[model samples]
Target: MTLAHQTLALQTLGLSKSFGGFRANSDISLCVARGARHALIGPNGAGKTTFINLLTGVVPATSGTVRLLDEDVTRVSQQGRVKRGMARTYQINQLFADLTPIETVGLAIAEREGAGARWWSRVGQNSAVVDEAEALLTRMKLGEVMMWRTATLPYGKQRLLEIALAMACKPKLLLLDEPAAGVPEDERHDVLDSVEALPQDVTVLLIEHDMELVFSFADRISVLVQGQLFAEGGVEEISTDPRVKAVYLGEDAHV
Candidate 1:
């Protein structure tokens, strides 16, 4: 049963979350195929964040299991998950305001290289780390501001830097939580394009409300409505789904 045994890069079975008698997620089961570009979309308060938090161990699921590469990780800590090739970017950038982009990305690179504890040594001694840090920043199109302070960069650039930082860990599964959020439309495409260009080995699971971006970037789409999966299909199937359209109402970006 090789086909039946095909391991997913990420999978959730009956994943559920609740708070004070309120159910934020309900028995959700889903999978992201290896190297797939998958998007999860839902209306506000549809438990998108709650679901993400469950995957990242930000919150314990009320009941369910999570698997990475077919290995059970439902109880893994967030850091543990990161150590196992899982990395994510948030809707809001969480950056070290005082560190330069180069320095910030360098730190992630150093950690990945197991040189973090020895970073006090001269930068020249860590040529490999420096090279990799630079490469990741450049790949994310942040090379021009690589030496700039994190706090001083524009919001869009900050988002890009966050992605660069995530990539520095060399994740097998990259979870992007609204990477284009708060970015001007003019700048969003560039950011999304960089994300889309990521290598095939880095399976992506995107959670975004921007349907245009979602459609452009996802090979398949899943619609979550009121804490449950309502529909899932290819871009065309999702775009024309009557249930999804009803959920979006007058929002032109729904499709």
Candidate 2:
């Protein structure tokens, strides 16, 4: 898993963001190698979310450069980034409340396949999109609830559906913003397993607050505090870092 010679999915050099006199992110420089499971963690107000926004082109950086697949994309629009194999989920699930998991994912599949303009007319009649949607939901272990309305599903299942929706994009690099955020404790395992089983070739960068999930899922971690990279290393290195302990994890963090 040494990334030294691996191809990079993303590289940000001196990336920063500021609004008026307040600097939300400062000089973040990091690399996410192709197929790497990377996590960015920090305390509240640590600027992790801000950095994600900058990385995904939802917000422009005040300074720095971003390269995706070694191609400079510092100025790419947010939609433009999605076209270049970047996809993301949100801290809060963005779902069609009334749509069944199958329908929701079918729309995404249809969209990705360039049939979205006729989505309403294509539903139920399009075997290809329907079959693809079923396959993805099954892969996420959501087949049992494929017909359930998203709003009526358990919080955990809702999260799983969102991930499935993101996967429908067939992204080479996926960014997950707190995929496990609101799941009830009893159902967390399902969400965790779905993420663990993502295709090996799809690189992931997640912003999460769940330490156990972070340590278990990520191969590499970057700690950002006050919008700057406070620490970077393997799980063992970060788990033992005194500065990280004091700044983000506190004394109770297992690592």
Candidate 3:
């Protein structure tokens, strides 16, 4: 309860969510310090995704306080939350198939910054917005295929595009749901780096299955098991703890 030194960017106390007879999240509490790279790891059914839904207002929290920058956001709607500088990406690729990659990213920037208000007015015409979108594409490593239709790009590019879209919002914190999932094994490293390279002021809370990426990126790690928080610790402590290894790491020895 005492968060004096915590400098929490986002915090949840005694959070829970239920669907009919099933409890998706139970008494889950976490504090992500301002600018911290926090990673959440768990087995397949641990309710990691559901927890994110509750925080982002995609689903209402059954009971709890959700705070952003020390201000309560438990009841704020999703769209309102985005305007307040919260953004996220999904497990599945979410992009406009018919639009060119540049156009799609352009729309996201416009939506977030209100620069793309004139839809019928030439999308690729705004010099400032186009410059910003192109830079984002380059930073996210999607420059080579900037002109390709989103649907035509490779899976990895599509995934990167989603991140770019989130960045357009200029969010203070980004919630990434399994970013490396479905990305090629060889390309996972770069994708992880792209995430790390994001603005230091932008805190990240990610759900990831790749142990190597998780251990390398997370400043802190929290384990979820059967819809409850099993443990929370700094990177080294979580990686070495026997209980964490038993439940989440399994046969894979700690890296």
Cα lDDT of model 2 by residue, 118-204, tens digit: 735747788999999999999898999999988999889899988998899889989999999988888988999899999999999
TM-score of 1: 0.93
Sum up the clashes in candidate 2.
1
What is candidate 3's lDDT per residue for 1-255, written digit by digit as tens? 556535888989999998998999999989899899999999999999899999899999999888887788998999888888889999998789999878887887888777657858786778788898999998899999999988898888888888888998889989998888899977777777888788999999988888888898899999999999999999999988888877865766544
**Candidate-wise lDDT, in order:** 0.88, 0.88, 0.87
What would the per-residue lDDT of candidate 1 be over residues 1-255, giving only the tens digit for each residue?
445436588889999998989999999999898889999999999999999899988999999999987778999998888888889988888899999999998888888877888846875478888888888888888999988889999888999988888899899999999998899877777788888788889999999998888998899999898899989999999999877897888566455
The alpha-carbon RMSD values of the candidates against the true structure, listed in the order shown, are: 2.6, 3.1, 2.8
Q: Lowest summed lDDT over 10 consecutive residues: which window, candidate 3?
A: 246-255
- TM-score to native of every candidate shown: 0.93, 0.92, 0.92
lDDT of 3 at 171: 90
